[model samples]
Target: MNRIPLRAQALGARLAYALPRPLRRAIAGRPIRIDGQELALDAQLLITLQRLSGAGMVNETPEASRRKLEASERLVSGPPIEPVTVRGLVLGGVPARLYEPAGVGDDAPLLVFYHGGGWVVGSLDSHDNPCRFIAVNAHVKVLSVDYRLAPEHPFPAAVDDAVSAFRHAVAQAADLGVNPDLIAVGGDSAGGNLAAVVSHQQVLAGGPVPAFQLLFYPGTDGTTRRRSRDLFADGFFLTSDQMDWFMDHYMPEQDRRSDPRFSVLLAEDLSGMPPAYVATAGFDPLRDEGEAFADRLAASGVPVVKSRQADLIHGYINFLGVGTRFREALSEATGALRTGLALSGRKGADLNT
Candidate 1:
């Protein structure tokens, strides 16, 4: 197999090792203190921070982080894409981007995406490439949502916006030029959490349920501590410390931590949900919970497919041309969408052509 160059790999490892001992310890050992409260860090967050701190220091501000993302996008080659506008506003407001690929029809299936940033970061621009690739590869229109973030708008706000955006899509299906009945919801990390919650909310509200759910290393359980926390807590891009920071800024109130919308793993039931495509990174601390959620969904009779990228790390989906792994990940995800939309009975002329 062709591997990332040894020199690059070595450099990456060294950076991981160079993080301050205390910062590394905080990420790897002990619970994270957030707003004077001890919030136990999950494996995924721990690993994410370790990697971020190791490879490059964490961006202290949202703007700096966005710049890094913008710079990375300069590397990938995406297909012809166009944006669509979504109407009907809700709590977090209505902001959407529709990516139309080459040779796709007006009645194409749609993939609605939520960008990840621990509920506090990430936006439409931050995840543009991934959405474009999905639209092009799956031959479907991709609608990406820009939901409100936190410490400004906490729990239930993001969830509310996601559901609203989804409902707007369903209600204005013809206007958006797609088969409204054949929509899928997908996101990474916190965005994944939003997708799952929105799916549940839509089903409960008797709205159109998405045909498929694509979650990449989702934060399924915010309350339950898992073994992966201790095992992969350090040296990953997302750290337990950063997770605590995010949660504190995003949730704040401890009482709301167990709400199923915030922690889907704690939801009372998982039956009758749409088929799912869950992707997990081997080095991701969120790995276990994401897989566990898929297992639960499968056991509940949801047609679920789980892929664990053994050599890749968290946030690989947004890395674009940094490594071939991101492209491979996008292809697999879009393939799942193709099969998913087909099963849902939506047919675009180019779906399989």
Candidate 2:
């Protein structure tokens, strides 16, 4: 549990945002311009503060890292979105949370969401706020999948759980008060990778597939390094060292990283996958690969809304508590989710409409 009281943290966040832009900019230092895109002031301030704290996920044991993130997020993410009922449930034996906002109908759309932590550290609690935000804002139920992590479970465990949970959600949609045809698969970072793999698995199996996919700065290709990986490799919250730590723990074998199960971007056939909204952060290390995945999807004739959040960084999805940029970026994705669900089953419908 978080050490600081949620109320105090929320208050502090409010006060931080209440500061004038000039002062905040000065305190955060000069604007970070990389690859021709400037970082948002809020993001820069947050990064600056994080650097000043001298604490980071790098070099920490997974257990300690998890605890630190859980505590730190409470101080920044404000409070969880409210009036959205959360309940525990099991989908295909995977523990999950169902976030259903008040006033939603029985046949509401459901996003089977995977929490991002590089396939290692995050949990349902770590991602509770994002799920709640999506549920309320998208006007849909969010099935936040608590899949097994890596280092202990590793590789295909998270992928298996993701696919199973999504399949079960579709199969049991009515019992879960959702529409089967409107079910989407989504996640951030590692979670996004799982969602993309699940979409491919379902389609390849010639069976049920996700109606849509919501990917946030997803790790699309793990085998090859891209320019963004080097450009934003350091000081952007998710650093190269941390990423190496995650990969080393999650998939120790470097050769296997290119497997389509882990690297969805390398999949031979991507056609027939569901419509997707892939959001990449301009300053994120995974930015180029995520955009590459979206480009592949589009080239394969899949309807894709590839959005580059030019001022944000990786993990912005979880920073919804204090900043406007994060919220603004997420709002666009959630709105697209709502619209995607509405247009899901129409055979020839324009998804980008």
Candidate 3:
């Protein structure tokens, strides 16, 4: 539990993974190979594991859980981009924050972001770093919604908030200094699920469609168990217990799982949705479902860019200092965003990545 032991363990993990192929095999036995590359746990993840060793699947009250997270969590991100003006405001009758990169003004692209905390613990602060990175890297304004949490405001509440917030962002584009048509929607984990559902809801209503959808390790189907659940039930960061708690609080009724709003693939039609950029971690329990959703989107004639970080686990975005793959993945996803928003060929100032 001491810092010395933690650092030592992290060093050991790093050295162990760096050993020559035969030596590593001789010492730690064979490593799992994914996409023909060794899938050994990285040192940054070793430190994270040490920090999370004592944590359980949050059974305390939501407030207590949130406090626990805020007190202990440490997310070391990439070098901060200078002059990123981050400000908080109320949009669509809900809490939200805006991340504005330099040189962007009215008619610039924007993204309405949602944070991932299993519909429970995340807040504007928890996702601030990623929003900053997205805005600066993709050269777009990011509006992050602090939507209502669950048990107090359960299923359909977050969905409603996302739709309202996205609509508000587009409608008030001039005031917010962004192009109404280039407004995109995105999020991680549960937030990603909400973003996908939000897109579907808008299409079903036949109005106010977003320009793009950026989903990272989203939960697409909750009604039925998939092979991924069995294979990745335990370990790999996001455990089964945590997921069970999130689902129970968000949707207590099993029947509701069948709804297209929850089980997105069950939707009769996925047509008319915006372009999508999907990212998934191979070690994650939700990996299969996320990829499945991407396939569905492409099949529905939606332009899709899929990136699979096979060696990394879930929530790598928050593990900024711990991995280089996170940066690589973020850059790729943002590149897709730039293309979708037509930012690559813009005549004026371009975002330096």
Candidate 4:
């Protein structure tokens, strides 16, 4: 592995440390108060992300998704690489993207990726770079799904859309230039949750269960509050207050929170699921739950690899071009994906299916 230089790492850390105290405080805490009422961290982060997103910021929905997507976009853009588009008719709709890569011939294993945004934000455009990098680095085709978001569509709506998309991809594998049997599901945060749930749903529905699952700091259990939520909740990019806000906007009704389809951690059984590569960030409030979910999967006798990004915050995967550590983390992740996909004996299938 090519490690980042110490000086560069130090510079990145210093830059992170050098932000204005108030801005850092806001980045690390709740929103700034213009009045007596507390604005909360998610709102504050959204505003910060808006500034970072540059132009084309959408006014609808909370600021978190837009800002996160914008920051992610800026972090991953670089010189052009090989790009391919695979169209699939799913959920009575046509969805696709540019799958950039080198030596990604036909029959490469497919990675069906769902983008994260509290299940209310994120789209193919928001996560284009990461998907492209995964396609190129992992030597596989990545089918990035633009699942339906919440507020407008809630609960099973996202899951249903994801399942439909995955199934459609699998059914039309040949048309999309990949093997149907080598499909895997993956996502970050909320997208991670959807990937897990969708895999389980596929298993129950029978036929076409993903060969593997790649979950990055997934939002697992929605019921129990973990210790990390309080300990690392403040300074990290994702805070406990922000999580609550996301949950509020995402679930709204309390009844939906306990549904295993909505919260996979609440599921009664995790047996017979695909092997998993679970990544968590040390400073993230979602850390504990992600780790706990990995533990549960391990307990169920599934092959699992859990990695913690000690010096990073939430949503670091999307920052692959900004920091050396980000690329390192992405490389580690892609390596894991390659190993997992290879072990399934489906290597060389076009991944864009």
- Cα deviation at 217, candidate 1, in Å, is 1.0
Tens digits of per-residue lDDT, candidate 1, 146-226, equal: 898886778788888889888888878887788877889999999998899988887777767887898888999888777
Looking at candidate 4, the ten consecutive residues that score lowest on lDDT are 34-43
lDDT string for model 2 (222-291, tens) is 7888999999989898987788899988989999998999999999999999999999999999999999
Q: Please report how far candidate 4 places residue 244 from its true position, in Å.
A: 1.6
Pick the lDDT winner: 2
Between candidates 2 and 3, the lDDT winner: 2
lDDT of 1 at 10: 39
Mind giving the per-residue lDDT tens digits that candidate 3 earns over 7-86?
45445444555567576446533455544544544523433453544432264677776764543334233345556998
Model 3, residue 25: what's the lDDT?
Answer: 49
Off by over 4 Å in 1: 1-58, 61-92, 346-353
**C-alpha displacement of 37 in model 3, angstroms?**
6.3
lDDT of 4 by residue, 171-255 (tens): 8787767767778999999999989998888877776789899899999989888987886666456667767777887788886
Q: Candidates' TM-scores?
A: 0.77, 0.95, 0.85, 0.78
For model 4, state the Cα shift of residue 33 in Å: 28
Stronger candidate by TM-score (3 vs 4)? 3
lDDT of 3 at 255: 82
